[model samples]
Target: MSLSPQFLDELRSRITLSGVIGRSVKLMKAGREFKACCPFHNEKSPSFYVNDDKGFYHCFGCSAHGDAIRFLTEAKGLPFMDAVKELAQAAGIEVPASDPRSAQRQEIQATLYDVTAGAARWFEEQLSGIEGAEARTYVKKRGLDDKLVRAFGIGFAPDSRGKLKMALATHGHDKLIETGLLIQVDDKEPYDRFRGRLIIPIRDQRGRVIAFGGRIIGDGEPKYLNSPETPLFDKGRTLFNIDRAAPASRKSGRAIVVEGYMDVIALAKAGIDEAVAPLGTALTEQQMEKLWRLVDAPILCFDGDKAGQKAAVRAGERALPVLTVGKTLRFAMLPPGKDPDDIVGEGGSAAIEPFLAAPSPLVRVLYNSRLSEIDRSNPEDRAGLRHRLDDLAKSCTDKILQEEYRRSFTSLFFEDFGWKGRDRTVVGDAISRTRRDIKTYQSIARSALYGCFRFPQTLLRSLEDICKIDFDDDVLKIWREKIVDSVSARPFLRDDGVIAILEADMISPPQKFDITRDLRFSLNVSPEVGTARLTRIIRFLVENEALSKALDELNHRVINDTGMGNYVALEKMRADVRAKIKVIRDQEYESGATDAEADKEELGGAAGQSAASATA
Candidate 1:
C-alpha cells in the first residue's frame, strides 16, 4: 500500500505493456497502437487496443481498459501480487517481495522439499546396494535396465516395519511425518513411508520432490500408494517428471501427458523425455495451467484401454477452453491392454515414438468410440454414425479446434463405415447442441475465487495477468469480473457462504452445483489441516489494501455496465456478504470487539455495496 502512484508510473515505464500483454494474447500493430479482439469480450472486430506508449489497453466497446497490471489481474483473476509477479516474470523484471511471512512459509516448504529429495536418494542407494536384488530383478523383467532404473530413481523400500524410518531417524529426520516421509500410526512408532514397494518420487517442474508414489512390490490390497496431502504436496497441483520433461516439452512444443508415475518414467527412460503425469489424483485445471507454462500444446496419452480412454476424454474436455488459440492438443492411445510404458518396454520407445509425435483430435476418438459400440455391421448403424458426428461438431465451442477435428474425423468415418462422398446425414442432431464439455470445472469455477484464495494479499493480481479474456461472450465477462471483485475481498468464507457465493457467479445452477461438489472434494482432501489451509489461502490472496481498492474499481465496472444487466448474481452476492457480515457482527457483539476485524469487514462490505449500488 505504501507504493505510490509515482512508483507505479516508473515501474510501467520500465516494462512494455504490449510485450506483457503479448505473453497470453497475440497482438499486431494497428497503426500506432497494437490491436487485438478484446479477449475480455467476444467480438468479431478488434476493439481491445493497447497503446504501447501510454502503457494502457482500452476496449472502447466493452469499456474494459487498464494498464499492464490491470490486464493481468482481469485476465486470469489472480491475486494482485500474483498478477504483478506474473507480469514481472513476463517482462523479465524482478518483483520486490512484500511480506516476510511468505518468505518464512517458502523456507519451511523448502526444508520439507529437501527432506523428500534426501529420502529419494536414500531409497535409490538401497536399491543399487546389495539388498536390492528383488527390486532390481522386478524392473529388469519388465525390460528396464540399470540405466533406466537410475534415470527414474527406481528404488526399493525395505519390507521391515521401521526400516527406512530408522534410516531417516538416524540421519536426524525425526520430523519425517511433517515432511510426509515417515508415517506414524499413534505417535508411538514411525514406519517406512513406502514398505516393500517401488518408490517413485513426485516433483514439480522445478524438480522439487514434494511428494512420493510407491508401487507395491507384490500383490497388495491397494496396488499403489502415494504421499498423503502435505504442505509441500498438493496431489492436484503436482505432476510427475514435469521438471525432467519440461526441457524436451519446450523444445518439442508439446508434451505427452499420461496416467501414472511409471508411464512417465518408462517413456523418459525409453528416450521419450517429454512425458509428464498427474500425481496421485485426476488431472486438474491447475495441472493444465501448470503444463501450459512448459509446452504450447499438450497431448493426452492414456493407455488404449477402457478406463484410460474415458480419462482422456474427460481431460480433453477440460483442456479445450483453456488451450490458447494457435496452441492445440491431441490424444494418443497405446494398443488395447497396453500403456505407454508397456508398449515401449516390450518394443522399445522407438515403436511408440510415432504416436507421441503427432496430435490426434478428440473427435476421432469420440466418433470411433461411438461407432465401435453401435453394431457397425448393421445397416442402421451407418445412419446413426453420420448424425452423431454432426451433433458432436456443433457442440464444440472453439471453431478452429472443431474444424480440424471435423476434417480428420470425416476421413476416418468414411473409411470405417465405407461411405464415400460428403453426405452429411446426421440424425437426432439437436440444433442447439447440448453442453458436452467434459471438464467437471473442479477448479475453473473457483478459478476467480481461488485466484484470491491462493494469494490473499494480491487478489487483484490474477485479473491483471491475462491480457485478454475469451469466454466468447460479453455478458459472461461481466459476470466473471463481478465474481472476481466480490470474491477477492473475502478473507475466508464459511462453507455455506463459499457454496452460495460460488453458485451465484456461475452461468447455470448445475455449474454452480458442480463447483460446490468439486471444491468440497478438493478441500476435504487434507482433513487435518483443511481449515488452516483455507484460511491461509484467503490471507494470501487479499494481502494488501491497494489490491482491495483495485478490485473494488474493477467490480464496479462489471455492475455498472448496463450491457451486463441486473441478474440474480449481483443480488446473491449482496445477500451472501450481508449474511456473512452479520455472523461476524454477532461474534464481535459477544467478544471484546477489536478494531482490526471490524474495520476490514467494513471495507470489504463497503466494496461489495458499491458494486451492488452501481447496478442499482
Candidate 2:
C-alpha cells in the first residue's frame, strides 16, 4: 500500500535535508544552502545543493532530484518501500497498519488540530472585545502597535473559566480538553486551562497551532502558564516563533534564542525577526538541535538578572553532551537589570544589536560561568573552578572535542592564575644566570657613579676632570652625564632628590639587565662617605690607567732600541713606573673594601630609612 501524503510530508519535515545528504557527500554550507560535488555524476565544482527549508537535494549537473526517501532509494540503491521504512524509523514515525482504525485515528487527530485552531481564533476575537480591554492596555504599554499585534497574533483569555468552553462549544468539550484548551477532572466538569491571561499561540514548523502560552495580566500566582504536553505538543521539542524565525534566520545568517515568547515578540517588533524561545523551560537538547538546523550556532540572548544568568548556565550544561563539531550556542546577556524589551524601550533596536553581533562562544560561556562562581585568589575556590571546567569538558561524548576543550581550559587557567608550564625550570635557570651577570655589571659601574649623583656638591668641581676620562662602561658614562645635567639644573641636590633623578632616567631599563633594584645601594652611603669614596675610586681608576700606559711605552722602547745608554734609561723609567703601579694597586684594593665597610657601618639604618621612603 502507498504511504499517505501527510505522513510523507511529516517524515520530510522531521529529517533535516543537509544532514541526510552530508553523510555521503562532504557538504559545505554555502549561504543558506549546503553545496557538494554532485554524487550522481561529479565533475567536481560542487553542483549538488541541499536546502533544509525546501526539504530536498538537487544536482544541477545531472538534473537529479529527490527528498530524503528518494535519495535513499536512488543514491543508496535501496528499494522504494525499504527507503520509506528506513526514513520513517529515523523520523520516529510508525507506518500505519492496513487496519481501518489507523485512518480513523489520523482523522481524529486532524479534528484536534482544527479545535486548537478554532480556540486560537476565538481568543484573538476576545482580545478585541470589551473583556479584552485590560490586555489591550497591557499590549499598548508594551509598545506593540496594531501591526505587531496582528503579526504575532496576540490574544486574551476571558477571566471566566467557562467562557472558552462555551465559545467553542460546537467543537465539543471533550475535543477541547484533548487539544489542551481545557482541563479535565475525574468527576467534575471540564474547565478552561487558561484564564485572565494574555494568550499566545505556539506553532510547529508548518505554522499550525499545537499549543498555547498565557501570561497573567496583573499580579497573579504563576505569572506564565503553558499547555500541558499533548500528542501534538511536546514542550521540550518545540520553540516559540520557530516557524517565523527559520526564514528570517536564513536571510540574516543568524538564529537568536531568547527566554520567552514576550521577548521574541519584543525583538521582532525591533525588526529583529530571527528570534525564538523555548516553551516555558530551560533549553533542551532537542530544542538546540532544532535551532542548529537553521543556523550552525544560534545566539542565546538571556536576561541579565540572576535568574536569567542561571538559566543560561543551565542551557550550557545541557548542551555539553550533544555539542558536536560546528554545532554550539553563543551566549549574550543583556545589561544588568535589562531584557530585550527594556533595552529596546530605552534605546530602540540599535541598543541590543552589538550584543547579538558578538555573543560569546559556548566554551567561553561555560568557562566564564564557572569562573564567576568563585574567587580565583582562594586556592580552594580556584581548584573548584578547574574541577568544574574539567567536568564540563568530560561530559562531551566526542573524544577529539573533549581533548581540545581540556587543552584550551588548562591553558587559560594557567595564563589567568600565573601558573608556569613544564619548561619553567630551564627558563628559570637561564634567567638566574642573566640576572647575576647584570648584578655584576651594575656593581662595577656603581662604584664610581653613585657618589656623583648622591653628593653632586662634592663632585661638581671635579666634573670637568672626570668627563675627560674615557670610561670602559657605558652606564658609568651615562650616569656621569646625568649628574652633570642634574647639578646644572639644580645647584645643590638633596639625597632623595638625586635618587629621584636616577629613577626617572632608569624608567625603561635595558633589556636583559635590571640595575634599578640594586640602585638602592646608594642609600648605604652618607654625603661625607660618598665624597671621600668617590675621590679615591675615580683617582685610582684614572692613575692606574696612566701608569699602565707609561709602562707599556717603556717596554716597547726597550724591545726596539739598539743603544745600551737608551736601554738603560728606559729600564730605569720602567722600574719607577712599576713601583708607582704597585702603590696604586694596593690603594685600589684597600680603599674599595675600606669604603664598603665604612659605608655599611655608617648606614646600618639604611634599610629602615629605605622602607620609610618606600612607604612615603
Candidate 3:
C-alpha cells in the first residue's frame, strides 16, 4: 500500500516522536529534544536523541537514525504497512484504502496544492505590477522592503471579483473553489475570495503554499481576511511562518507566537526569525502543540490591552488539559496599542527583546488574571478566588504538574494575602512582631556565617559586611571574629583552613532552620554562585540587622512615651524600618538564590562537627 506524502506528514505531525519512543526507550528531556542510552547499542551514557520537531530519532553510538515508522520497522521488527497502520490508528486518522477512489482523491488534493501555488504566484506578479500600486505603498509605509516582500511571497489581490479567477483559470473553477481561491454560490458564478488586499501566503511545514491571508490596503469592513478551511488548510492546525520558524526556533532554542502575520514579519525584519502567528483566532491547542515540537516553552506575545490579557488567559486555559511536565507556555505583552510591528518599526528588535526575554510563566498569568477579578476585602470573594485557582490547577492533565501548579498557586496566594480567619487582631499583631523580631535577623546572620564557613572565599569577599554583622548568638559572634581574623590574615583561606579555625574555637556551623533554608543553601553553595550574588546576600543580611535594631529601639520608645506626638513619631519610625526590611527580603528573593539546591552535603567534616557541637 502506498501512502501519500501529505497523509504521512499529517500522521507524523499528530504523533509526538518522543511519546512514541518513550514507551520503550525511557527518554529524558535534553533541551529541545529527548535523549536516552542508545537502544541499538549498549551504551551507559545517553547518546540517542529524538527530535519531535524534525520527526526523527538518531543514535550517535550505533549510527541509527529513522522516523517513527522506521523506528517501528527497524527497532521493533514490524513491517512497513503494519507500522504505518499503527501510527495512523494512534493519530486517529484512517489509513487510506489502496483502491482507485483513494488514489483519485489524493490526486485531486495534489491538484489543489498546485492551484494554491499558482494563485500565490499570480498574486506575487500582481503586487509587482501596476495593479498592486496601493498595496506596494502600504508595504513601503509599513517599512517592509523588497526582500521581505519576496521572502514572505507577499502579493496583492486586485479589487475585482474575477481577477484571481481569471488568473488561475487554467487550474479550473472547481479546483480554485476547492483551494478557497474562489467562492461559489448555488447558481451564481464563482468569485474571488480575496480582493483589494495585501496577500501573504501561508505555507505548510514543507514550505508549500497551503493558503493565503489578505490584509486590507484601505478602509474596509474586516481589516484582514483568511482563506476558508480547505482540503489543504486547517486554520487551527496551521501557523503562519511556521515553515521558516521551526528551524529558526530550533537554532535559537525558543519559539515566539505573535498575534498576526504582520507581527511575525515585523519580528523577522528585526532579525528575529523564530516567530509565528495564529490566523485570525485565539491560539489553539494544535498550534501550541506544533510549537512545543520545536521548543519546550513558546512565548505568546499579546498586546498589552485588557482584550489581549483575556486572550492570553483563554489560551492558558485551553493549554492546561494538554500540558505535560516540560511542555508549557509563557506570555509576553507588548505595550498598550503597540505590537511587535510598532515596537520593531520604532526601535528595532532591541525594544522588543526585553519583553520577550522576560515573559511571565503560564501559572503566574492565570493566577494574576483570576486575582484581578476578585474583591480581596471580602472573605467570600477570597474563598471564591481560592476555589477558582484550584479549578484552574486541576485542569492540568499531568498529575505531577497539576500538584506542582497547586503548590505554586497556594504559595502565591499566601504570599499575596497571608493567613486569614483567626483572632484577626492577635494574628496581625503576632505577624507584625515576628517581622521585627531579632530571631529573624539571627537566622539570617547565622545562615550567612554558615555559608562563610563552608565557602571561605565568601568570607573574604564579604569581609567588610561580615565585620559589621551583629550576631545575636555568642558562639556565632566568636566564630565570626575567628573567621574574619583568619581570613584577614591569610586573605585566601580554603574550606579546610576555615574548618580548622572553627575546630580550634570549639565552634560549629549553624544548624539549618526552616526559615533560613534558602539563604543557607545559597551560602553553602557559594562557589557555584558568583561573588557578586554572595555579597548581595551578605549586604541584605547586614541591612536587615540594622532595621531590626531600629524597630526594637522604636518599640521601646513607643512603650515609654506618653505624648501622642511622640508615639506617632515612634510608630512612623517603626513602620519605616519594617518597610526597609521587607524591601531587603524582596531584593534577596528576586536575586534567584532561593531556588538553589538544598541537598548539598556539608563541606569537609562540618556535618559531624555540627552534630558533636549540638550535643555539647
| lDDT winner | 3
Candidate 1's displacement at residue 49, Å, is 36
Candidate 3 C-alpha lDDT tens digits along 210-319: 99999998888799899999989999999899877865675467899888899999999999988999998999999887788777999999877778778888999999
User: lDDT scores for all predictions?
Assistant: 0.63, 0.75, 0.79
Tell how far residue 217 is off in model 2, in angstroms. Answer: 1.4
C-alpha positional error of residue 141 in candidate 2 after TM-score superposition, expressed in Å: 1.4
**TM-score per candidate, in order?**
0.49, 0.56, 0.59
- In candidate 3, how many Å is residue 265 off? 0.4
Worst 10 residues of 1 by lDDT: 427-436
In candidate 3, stretches whose alpha carbon ends up further than 4 angstroms from where it belongs are: 1-101, 419-616
For model 1, residues 163-195, the per-residue Cα lDDT tens digits are 777776644545588867777777576677678
* Arranged by lDDT, best first: 3, 2, 1
Candidate 3 overall lDDT versus native: 0.79
> What tens digits encode model 2's per-residue C-alpha lDDT throughout 1-616?
6878998888888888787777667889899999888766636588888989988888888888988887765564344665676677677787775678866776687788898889889999999999999999999999899999888778999999899999899999888888889898987999999999999999876567899999999999899999999877999999899877875675577889989888899899889988999988899999988787777889999898988988998998899899898888888878888887788777778999988888987787788888888986699998988998999899999998899888777766764674243334543454344334333333433545655655676566456656655666676677677777887788788756766787788832233433454342343555766665555555655654565556456545533333356456654654555555454334333356755775465355554666898999
Candidate 2 global lDDT: 0.75
Worst 10 residues of 2 by lDDT: 433-442
Worst 10 residues of 3 by lDDT: 595-604
Better of 1 and 3 by TM-score: 3
